[model samples]
Target: MTVIVRDLRPGTPADIEGFIRVRHRALPYVFFSPASVLHGLSLPRPDAHARKLLAVADGEIIGTAQVGLAEDSREPGQGSLNVYVDPARTGRGAGTLLVRTAEEHLAAHGAVKLFAWVLDEPADRAFAERHGYRPSRSAHFLRLDLACAALPPLQDPPPGVELRTAADFADDPRPLFALDAEAGSDEPGDIATEFTDYAAWVDEYWNHPHLDRELTSVAVADGRPVAFSVAHTHDAGRYRTGMTGTARAHRGRGLAKLVKNDSLHRARAAGYTEAYTGNDADNGPMLAINKWFGYEICATEVRHVRELG
Candidate 1:
């Protein structure tokens, strides 16, 4: 059977759903929704040039690729093309076709460096290496059965600290943005990203399609947001941790655990049955926190990078 690669049509609901379905089957670690897919395509950042690529065999989508440039990075000419093939449809040339098409698209737009995330399995890693990509840092996907798992009991806030939801900042999310920028800068990763674009943040994150403000727990101290657990609910009865971090000055205060616990409890109370989150392999503190909450490592992916001329 001939495998064909093409650009995903955002206006076609079935196309979007098919693309997301293949992604979920191949990489069940992260969250994917029709809304988030379209939101990314609608990004105002011209440099992103984000396009969804699909590999089809016999009228069925068997692989998906998110091809784009990281125009926002401080480094120039950096791009990303993450590909995922349905686990049941491997060895059908769909993966290779998707990657080749995505690379051509990114190269046409001036990407001198490319990065991709491959599953930690031997075959996945070998495929990346064969494609000229080298391994880098690794990350883990954790899952918590909110319907049955025993979560850490909710605890009272330490003195001077109060727990609240992101909705509390509906009038003004500037403080949350500041906190996010500060905390996110300290995360472990190969790419050093700085979030100075407040308006963009508001458009992409604060107003995102899946952002659950009511379930997003925040910790405030001295009238400011010190820590937060951003919640994203794309599928019914399922919750994903969009971002969980504490301000620099608020680190080591157990605030991350506090807010995350609160968010998990809120998710459960609101009928969410599953919770998922990702962790950098080197992020011991956060990994420990998630472990304490009964989150188990369900999958791992290694970041891979290739240089282009």
Candidate 2:
């Protein structure tokens, strides 16, 4: 059987569904939906040059790749190409074909350094190393059975701090943006991103298809948002932690834990039965917090990078 690689047609329902299926099977810890996929493709990111590619055999999509530049990073010529092959369809050269196509696309866009996330399994690590990529920091995907796990009981905020939902900021989300930007800058990762464009943030994150403002908890102190736990929900009672952070001045106040716990309790009340979150291996504070919430590490992925000559 001959396997071929091609660009995914955003207008085709089958193409979108097939891509989502392959991705979910390959990385079940993360969330994926038709609306979220389309939303990402529709957004105008000229500098990113983002493209979704698929590997097909017998007209069936067997693998997928998301190729794009890290447009928000301060560094220049950095790109990302993550490839995932359906577990049942591996060993047919689809993975290799997808990687080759993704690299070509990123190179065409002037990428001097390439980064990819590979599963921590031996075979996956070997595949990345064979492609000239070296392993970097690793992250763990944590999952909680929201319906059964004993979540930390919701606690009242300390004096001078009040708990609020992201919906409270619907009229003016700039404060949340400021908090997100500040916290995101300190996040552990290969790419350092800057969120200078509030308009872009509004379009990409605040308006995301899966963002559940009602369940997203925010902690306000000194008349501003000091901590938050962003939430995203999809079909099948699934809930994911998009981000959880505390502002610089708000650190060590237990606000991060307070807001996240509040969000989790609300999510359970709203019928979400499964919760998933990812944490960098080096992020000890966040990891400890998640473990305390009864979340168990279900999967791990290592970031790999390769420099272009």
Candidate 3:
């Protein structure tokens, strides 16, 4: 069977649907939708030179790859590509073809180093090793049965703090952006990111198609957002935590747990049957908080990197 790679046609429904189908089958722990996929492609990232490629065999899409530079990283020449093939259609050379095409695209964009996430499974890890990629760090994908899990009971905010929803700041989300920038800088990851552009953040995150403003909880202190739990929901009755963080100054005050719990409770009440989130394997505090909420690690992926000479 001959497999060919081509750029995804954003205007074509079949292409977008195939991309989403392959992604969900390959990485079910995360959320994906036509809107989310299109939104990501529509966002401007000139420096990143982002491109989405699809591997087609016999007129059917068998694999997908998103290739781009790590534009937000403080470091230069960091390339990122994540390729996923339909689980039922492996061994057709689609994965290898997609990787080769993605690497070529990134290299043409002046990427000096390339990073990819491979599932912790033996075959996946071995494939990465064969491609000269070395494992770096791992992260876990957590799932909670919102329909039946014994979630922690909701609690009111402590003194001097008020619980709010992301919608409350809809008119002006600058404060939330400020909070996100401060808290997100501390997230554990190999690629260090600096979220300094407010307009870009607004387009990439604030107006994202999957973000659920009403279900996203925030903790306000001193009349500003100190902590927040960003929620994303799709039509499949699934809810995901895009990010949950607290300002450094408010870390010890239980604000992170407060906002997350609030968000989870509201998400469950809103008919989201499943909740999903991811955490760096080394992030003990967030892991502990998730455990307290009855989330179990369902899957893990190891980050792998390769240097291009």
Candidate 4:
């Protein structure tokens, strides 16, 4: 079989759908839609040089690679490329071709270091290792049966702290951004990211197509957002927590749990039958909180890195 790699034709609706199809088959724990795929390719920063590639065999899409430079990273020459092949169609040379095409594209863009996320499965890990990538931090994907699982009862917020949604701050989301930046920096990961570009954050996150502001819960103290749970849904009965975090000053007060619980309750009530989120394996506190919410680990992935001179 001749597996050839080519740039994704964003102008073509079928190409976008095909890319999403392969991604959904490879990573069912995460939601992918044509809009999300298009946003990723067209909304990235100019310097990011983001490109989406597809591995086609016999006129069918068999694999995909999302390659781009980390323009927002504080570190220089850093790049990221996450490849996914149809689980039912592995070992067809598509994965290798996609990775090679991606690496070449990133290298041409002056990427000095590359990062990829490989499923913790033996075969996936072995493939990354064979490509000179070393394992790093890991994260767990969790899912909750919103239709059957018993969610923790939503509790009333403590006095002086009111609950709101991201939609409530549509006119002024700077406070939410500040809280997100603070909490994101504290998140456990191998690559440290600083969300200093407010404009970029607004475009990439706040205004994202999947973000459901009305479903996102925020905990406010003294009229300021101290914690938030960002929600995303695809109108397909699946809901996901894009992020849930509290400001450093508000930690240890259960604000993170407060917002997340509120969001989950709302999601369940709004006809979403499934919920998903991810946590760094080392984040015991968050992991415990999620367990208390009846979320079970469905899958895991390990971060891998390779150096490029």
Candidate 3: where are CA atoms >4 Å away?
none
Q: Write the per-residue lDDT of candidate 2 for residues 78-132, one digit (tens) a residue.
A: 9999999999999999999999998888898899999999999999999999999
How many clashes would you count in candidate 1? 0
Please, what are the lDDT tens digits per residue for candidate 3 over residues 1-309?
899999999999999999988998999998788898899999988999999999999999999999999999999999999988898999999999999999998899899999999999999999899999999999999999999988888888999999999999999999999999998899899999989999999999999999999999999999999999999998889999999999998889999889999999888888999999999999999999999999999999999999999
Question: Which candidate gets the maximum lDDT versus the true structure?
Answer: 2
Model 1's lDDT to the true fold? Answer: 0.91
Task: Give lDDT: candidate 4, residue 190.
Answer: 70
* Global fold similarity of model 2 (TM-score): 0.99
List candidate 2 stretches off by more than 4 Å: none
The 10-residue segment of model 2 with minimum total lDDT is: 149-158
Compose the digit string of candidate 1's lDDT tens values, residues 23-76: 888887677898898988887987788888988899998899998887668787
Cα-lDDT of candidate 3: 0.94
lDDT of 4 by residue, 109-128 (tens): 89999999999999999999
Candidate 1 clashes between residue pairs 3 or more apart in a chain or in different chains: none
